[model samples]
Target: DASWISNGNVNGLGWSLKDQMGSEYFGLRACNRSLSALHAEMEGLLWATSCMRDMRITSVRFETDCSDLVDMTTNPMEWPTFATEIEMYQRLQEDFEDVSLSHILRSRNGRADALAKKARNRGYIFSHIDQTRSYGGVLRRIGSYIST
Candidate 1:
């Protein structure tokens, strides 16, 4: 549920700039770091969602694996956010509900400690998960379900 790691610089140059974190594909990078694989990060997102579902929770926290997801989800009406396939986009939008998303250090992904079980070769060294919010406002409606 929590993860953090010191990621390295851009182009192997120096440490990453925190403010630039949200702009990248992954979350924020740490200084003096290693390459973070994209597939692993994506897997992390998938696992988190699964774990939340297993908990019987409609609302759950998630760490971003890419700003792409964030930028897309936030723009509900934007054309690009729709994934070009109407049915796919509609399904994705529904799944996104109750997803309280945010970015975190890779070290904090407890379940991810198992190495994402991915081949090291197929990875994305994105320095940032670029965390953000998702699937908002589910709890406010809980009262309606409770019934007076």
Candidate 2:
């Protein structure tokens, strides 16, 4: 998973799973009660960190539309509630030779948003569609939303 987008309060988190070529291969959405947006964001990041470790991805760039999250993860700022996540992210960063985090405009995060919306509308927390045979159309749609 490379990026995440959260649906409304009732819904959950949507994440984009991409391959080495930067082509989206799967979309994962999950719900957990008693968690705020911040928690979901952290969870998504944590999930991505774990996946990267499992896939042995040592060099990676993570993009998020949430500027606050980017700041928190990239800076020394911390919140009492987010302490755990902050530490986890920091530790994860340490394990990598090169890991970068950046903030992107929501408009440029259309793929993640689209996946989140699909999850919300369908009331499904998880869905994975192999794009090897039909990624062209999705990529085209995503191209318009990602700014150069």
Candidate 3:
């Protein structure tokens, strides 16, 4: 999910990855230059893809509430405005064995939506990785420190 604060020209991007059981394994919230909500959604997906690649995740199915994003990603030629970003996504997909993007109802994406809104409101960046389950690693926070 992504959010924009017009006053500060801040764009907040957020994404959450969950297993079949619906437990979150990874999530991120970041602030960036102001962009349209659609562009911000694409940025969030790019960030999520890069993070999953770093974790050596071989297969992924990304879900977003933006139908236009899904169409743009699935058929890049159809969305000229996002041609560069679509090309970037293709490059990132090479690292994975399989990848797919789907659209979901906005109501079903509350967590990611909240994270994006929080980042927009706070005007900062942060990431939360739940590595404790299988990676035998502690939760890591890397970014500006600010009170909630």
Best by TM-score: 3
Computed on alpha carbons, the lDDT of every model, listed in order, comes to 0.34, 0.60, 0.75
Name every residue pair that clashes in candidate 2.
Answer: 29-125
Give the root-mean-square deviation of each candidate in angstroms: 15.4, 7.1, 4.8
What's each prediction's TM-score?
0.33, 0.68, 0.80
Shift of residue 119 alpha carbon in model 1, Å: 6.5
Those runs of model 2 whose alpha carbons end farther than 4 Å from true positions after fitting are 1-11, 17-22, 124-148
Please identify which of the two predictions, 1 or 2, would achieve the higher lDDT against the true structure: 2
**Which prediction has the highest lDDT against the true structure?**
3
Q: If both were scored by lDDT, which would come out higher, candidate 1 or candidate 3?
A: 3
Candidate 1 runs further than 4 Å off:
1-47, 76-98, 106-114, 117-148
How many residue pairs clash in each candidate at the backbone level?
18, 1, 0
Summarize candidate 2's per-residue lDDT along 1-148 as a digit string, tens digits. Answer: 1222344433444555566654654445544432566666677677666656655778888788878778777664556668878998888888788988788898887776666556555554553433332354445223212111
TM-score of model 1 vs. true structure:
0.33
Output the better candidate (1/2) by TM-score.
2
